[model samples]
Target: MKTARLCAGLMAVLVLTVSGCSAADQAQNPSPTSAAALTSCPATPLQAPAGNGQAPQGPPMNELKVPVDTSTSKVIDPAGAKQIQCGRTQLKTTDDVAYSTATLANGTAKPLHLDIQVPAGDSAKPLVVYVPGGGFSSANRKQTLNLRTFVAESGYVVASIEYRVQPDGATYADGLADIKAAVSYLRTNAATYGINPDKVALWGESAGGYLASMAGVTDTDPKSRVQAVIDKFGASDISKLMADYGPQIEQGFANSPNPIGQYITGSPAKSLAASPEAVTAANPVTHADAGDPPLLIFHGDNDRVISPSQTLLLHNAMTKAGATSTRYVVHGADHGDLAFIGDPNAVSPWSTEPVVSAMVDFLKATLS
Candidate 1:
C-alpha cells in the first residue's frame, strides 16, 4: 500500500539525514528553516459548517469575455472541445493560503497553507482545490506544479493545498477536516481572490484522491460543498484494502521501523478503535447518495498499489445510490501512473495528454 511505502521512504530519509553525516558536517550544513514559518494568513478561527448535503450557491459569475462552451465531446480527445482555452497571460499566483493557527490532531502547529494561481481573466472563475498524493504521510504540493500550471492556464483559479499528513499525527478524519476548512476559507474570501465559490471542485490523486472522494460524499455547509470532484487512483475502502493486501502490508511493516508503528500497534483496543477499516468505512462510497456532486474518477487498470477495483466499487455505489459519477480505467497503467503525471519511476503505458484533457473537459462542463 502507498502508506507502507510512504512509511518506509520517510524512515529512509530520516536515517540518511542523521547517519549519513558527522556531527561537524551536520553543524556546517543545517537544515533549512521549516516552510511552516512562511505562513502569513491571519490566525482566524477555523470555521466549518455542519454537513447538510446541500449544494451551496456561490455568488453569480460575471460574464466571461470568452464564455466556455459546455458540450459533450469524445472523451478520448478532450482537446477537441472548444471550451479548453489558455489564458493570454501568465497566471497570477499567491502563496500560503492559510486557514488555521492552532495545532491540529497532527502534532505540528504549523498553519495549513495553499498556493493559489489565478488565470489571467478578470472574471470570477471557478476554483479548483488540488490535493496531492503522498500516502497520507507527506504533502507533495511541489509535485503537482505541472498539473497546477496546466489547469491554471486553462482559465480556472487553482489552489494547491497542503493538509495535515500522517507523519504529523493526522488521521483520515483530521485530513478531511483540514480540506473542509480550506474550502471554507476560500469561499469566505472568494471575492478577494476572484473566485466563484459555488463552482468549487476538489481534485486529488492517490491518497489525495481518497480525501477528495470523502469530501465529495460527506455533507458540508453550503460554503464548503464542492460542485464537482476529480479522484485519480485513490483507495475507496480501507477495510477492503486490508483484506486484499494483508500480506503486502505485513511485509511493509516488517521491512521498516515505521514511525507510525506505535500509532498502529500501541494498544490492541485502541487499534480497533483506529483501524483503517473503520476509518475507511466513513469514505466516499459509504456516504454516496443522491446529493453528491458530479464525480469523475480515473484509475489505472493495472494499479498494483491501490487496485482499480476500488474505483469500481465507488462508481458502482454512486450509481446504485443515484448520484452522478463517471469512471475511466486507463489500460496497462499502474497506481499514480495514469499516464506520465506522477512518480517517474512508475510505468506509464498511456499518454498523459489525453488524461489531462479529459479532466479539463470534465471541470469545464461541470463548473461552467
Candidate 2:
C-alpha cells in the first residue's frame, strides 16, 4: 500500500541525503536574493486561528485518560461529521479533470489531472493547490478531502493535483514542473472555474510540503508563482541530515535492500556521494528568495520520520532571506498523524479541525 510506502519511505529519506544526490553535476540554482526578486513581504505572519490546532484532551485509554487542550482544539467536525459550509454558499467538486500533459523521459505521453472543489457562485475565489505527499513516491489527490472541502467551504477554490513520483525517476525539479503546470492550467482557465488567478497558494504535506515550499520560493516563472504557502511536516534541508541522524539513520538501512534514497534521487547507492550542488538544488532553503511568498510551516515535536530540525532549517533560512515565514510546532503530534487530515486514521471529528481552521485562516489572511 502507498500508505505503508509513504510511512516507510520518509525514514528512508535520511539514507538518500546521507549518500547524496544522483545528479552531482548540476549547478545549484542560487537563492534569488538579488534586486530582481524585490517583492517585499510582511515581517511576520498571522498566528493559527485555534492555537496551532492542538488535539482535544481525552482520558487516557490505559493508565489514565489524558486530557486534550480544549483551549487550542475546536470541534469543527463532530462525530458522524458531515461537510460544514461555515454559513457560506454551498460548494461543488469537479473530479478527474485533465489539466495538463507532458512527454516523459522515455518518450511516453503522461497526462496530469486535478480535482477542484469550489463554491457555487459567480464571484472569483482564490485558488489553493493541494499537493499530496508519499515520500514523493505515491500521490493521492483525494487523500485529504476533508481539508479540501473545508477550505472550499471557506470560499477558496481548492485543486488537488497528482504529480510525477520519485519511483518513476521524477526528481524534485520534475515534480515542481508538474505543479507549475497545474497552476498555469488553472490560471489560464480561471474564468471557466471562477478562479482568482492572482490570489494563489500552495498547500502540501510531507513530500508535498517540500514541493510546496519549493513552489513558494521559486519565482523565476510567473505561471507557478504563488502568494502564500503551507508546509506540513516536510523536510527542508538534506545537507544536515547526515550529521543529525548519523548512526540513527544508517541502522535503518541495514536490512532493506531497496532504500528510498536511491528511489528518490534516481541514482544508484554505489554512485559517488553527491556534492553540495545536488543538496543545494533539492533543499528549499537554497532557493528561498527575497520575493518568496508568505509561508506557514507546521511540524510535530514528536515527528520521527522527518526531524523537526528539518523545518527549522527552512524557516530560519527564509526569514533570514527577507521572506515572511511563520512556523507552529504542534505539541505531542507525529508526522501526518492525528494532527493532519491526509492520513486514513485521521477520522476523528476534531483531529483535523484545528489545523484545517488554521489553514483556512492563513489563506484568508494572505490570499485576500
Candidate 3:
C-alpha cells in the first residue's frame, strides 16, 4: 500500500511535468523520468522491475546510467614511482600497478585502478576500496596516496577507483551509484583479484567521503553488502550545507573546476535531494546498527571547505549507535593538508602518518 501510494504521488508529479514544457516538444520528445525519481520515492530502496515491465519497485536503472567516455580521461603510469609490497610485511619497490575500467550508473566507463602494496597472499586478506574526492568535480586517483600508501604498506589490498564528475550531469547521486556499482563488481570478482569479499571496507575523501558514508549507512537490500566505511572530512548533509553555507558554497562554485550552472542541474531539488547534510537521515551515523561494520574518520580542525562539525556529527552518531568508531582531528590542518600535519621526519611527516597509522590499525583490527 505504501509503495502504491508513492507511485501514485509520482504519477501526479509527472502529469504536471508535461504541462510545464512546450506541448510540441512534450509530444515529440518526452522528458524521461530519472532513475531516482522512478525508483521508490525518497527514502526507499532501489527495487528491480515487476511483472508489467513498468518497474513496479521503482525507477529503471537505464534512466540513471552513465556511459564511459575515454576521451576525457588520463591514465598516469606510476612507472618509476616506488611500490610497497604487502602481506604483514611492508616492502616498498618501484613497480607499476595494474588498473582496469568499470561502467557507471550512467553506463559511462570509468577507470578502476589500484596499487597493490600488499599482495593479499593466500589468506584472502581484507580489502580496502578507496574512493577519490573532487567535490564531485575536482581531483583524481593520485591525490589519495597519503592514505592509500599507508593501507598498502599495512598488509592489505587497496583498490582505488575513478568515477564520473559532477556539473557535467554526473550529479552527486551519480557518484554514489558509480561507487556502489564498483563495490558490487569487486565483490563479484574478488577471487580473481585476490581479495576477501566478506571483509571489504569503503574509504573516501570529501564528496567521495560523503558517498562512502551514505553507502555504509544504507543497506543494499539484504543489509550486509558494505562491511565498513571510513570518511575523510566529507560533507554528510548536502542540503544543510547549501542552506547553512550558501555564501561559502557560492564562492566554492566560482572556484569550481566546471561551470556551476551545469553541475547544479544534476539535483533538480538542490539541497533537498542531493546535498550531503540534507541526506543525514540516511547517513551512516543515523542508520548505524550493531550489525553494521565499524567506522573510522579523520579530519583537520582548520578545514575551511568542510567544517569540523561534519566529522563530529558523524562520529557522535556512530558512537551512539554502539558501532566501533574513531574520529581524529589534526589541529592546524586544512583540507588535504595531512601532508603538513606534523613533524617532517617522522615516518611520513608530510602525509599525516599519525592519522594513516591509526587508519591502518583500525582496518587491521576490524577487517583481519
Candidate 4:
C-alpha cells in the first residue's frame, strides 16, 4: 500500500560549479548548477489553455502558489484518483478505459507494482512506461494531472510504475531491471492490452527521467529495449550529479540507488565498473549512435532541483549522436512545475499552450 506524507522543503543547497561550462555556455545549456539549483522564477509563466479536448473549467489566470511553508509530516491515508494532485493540469487520453496493476521481481518478497491504463479498443496501441520522480524516497503512480494522462491520450498504452526506494540501496539496479521487466511483460502481454511493443516509449520525470533515459540508451537486453525516450529533468551522469548537488551529496547518491556500486566489485584498479557516473559515459548519450531512437525532453529554465543544463546537455548529445531530439525549456517554469506551475490551462489566458502543444506535436511526430 502507498502512503502520502506532506514533505517540508529541505533547505539543502545542491550547487555544482563545473569549470568547463562558462556563463555563455551555461545560458545556452545551463550545466547542472549544484544539484539544488535554485533560481527565482516568475510567479506566473507565459500561460496557455489545455489542448483541444474536454477539460475542466477552472478560474482564469490561475497562479501557481508555492505551497505554504509549514511542517505537515503526518502520513495521511492515500486517497482514490480524486485525491492525488500532482498539479492542476490534466492529460486528455482518447477514451475511458480500465486500469490494472501487477508485481515483478525486485529481489523482494513484495512484487514490484505497476498500474496500467489500456486503450479503448482491442486495436494495438504503443505502450509507454511512465516513471515518477521523488528524489528516490517518495511519490507513487497517482493519477495526478501529470504526464501519465498525456501519454495515455496520445495513443499509447500508459503504465504508471512503482520501483523500490533507496532505503535498501538496491533500488536503482532493481528499478532499472524492473523497467526492463515491465517492457518484457508489456511485450509478452501486448495482445491482452492491445499494445504494440515495438513502439514502446519510456517517459520519466526527475529520478524516473534518469531511469527512462538509461533504458532508452541501453538496448542490449531485448526485454528492456525502449524505442523512444521522454526525459523530464533526468540525469545521465551520476558523477555530474555528485559534482552539482553539493551539500545533499548523500541524498542525491541515495536517490540513484547506486546500481553501479552494487553490480561491480573489485579493487580500485578495476575501474571499469566502480561507479554509475564512471560507467555512464557509455550511457544513452555516451553510446549514442546513429541508430538509437529519438528523445524528447521537457524542462524549465528556472528549475532548482535538476539543472536545465541536464536537459540541454542531453539534447546536444542526442543531436550530436545522430538521434533526433527536441527540448522545451519553459521560460518561467520550475522543476516539477512544468505540469501546472504556470497559468496555462483550459481556463486561463496565461496557460501552457505552447509547451503542451509542442509536447503533443513532438510525441506525434516521433512516437506516432
- Lowest lDDT 10-mer window, candidate 2? 17-26
TM-score of each: 0.69, 0.72, 0.60, 0.60
Question: What residue runs in model 1 are displaced by over 4 Å at the alpha carbon?
Answer: 1-89, 105-108, 242-277, 337-351
Of 2 and 3, the candidate ahead on lDDT is 2
lDDT of each model, Cα atoms only?
0.61, 0.63, 0.50, 0.50
Best by TM-score: 2
Clashes of 1: 0
**Residue 234 of model 4: what lDDT?**
74
| TM-score of candidate 2 to 2 decimals | 0.72
User: Lowest-scoring 10 consecutive residues by lDDT in candidate 3?
Assistant: 14-23
TM-score ranking from best to worst? 2, 1, 4, 3
Candidate number that wins on lDDT, 1 or 3: 1
- For model 2, how does the per-residue alpha-carbon lDDT over 1-368 read when each residue is reduced to its tens digit? 43334325544332111101112111223225433432111111111333567523221111111232223222232333322223244777698999888676677888889999889888999999999876666666766564566578778999999998756666677788899999999999999899999999999888888889988887568887888999987778755432233443433332232334443355545211343466567779888878889998876554556666677778888888988887776665555533222232322221334655677789989988
Q: Write model 3 residue lDDT over 65-176, tens digit each, in one string.
A: 1221212122122222222211234433222333446455477665644434345356666778777665555425554443465466566777776666653346555566
Q: So what's the TM-score on candidate 4?
A: 0.60
Candidates 1 and 2, the one with greater TM-score: 2
Off by over 4 Å in 3: 1-120, 221-224, 242-265, 268-290, 338-350
Task: Give the clash total for candidate 4.
Answer: 22
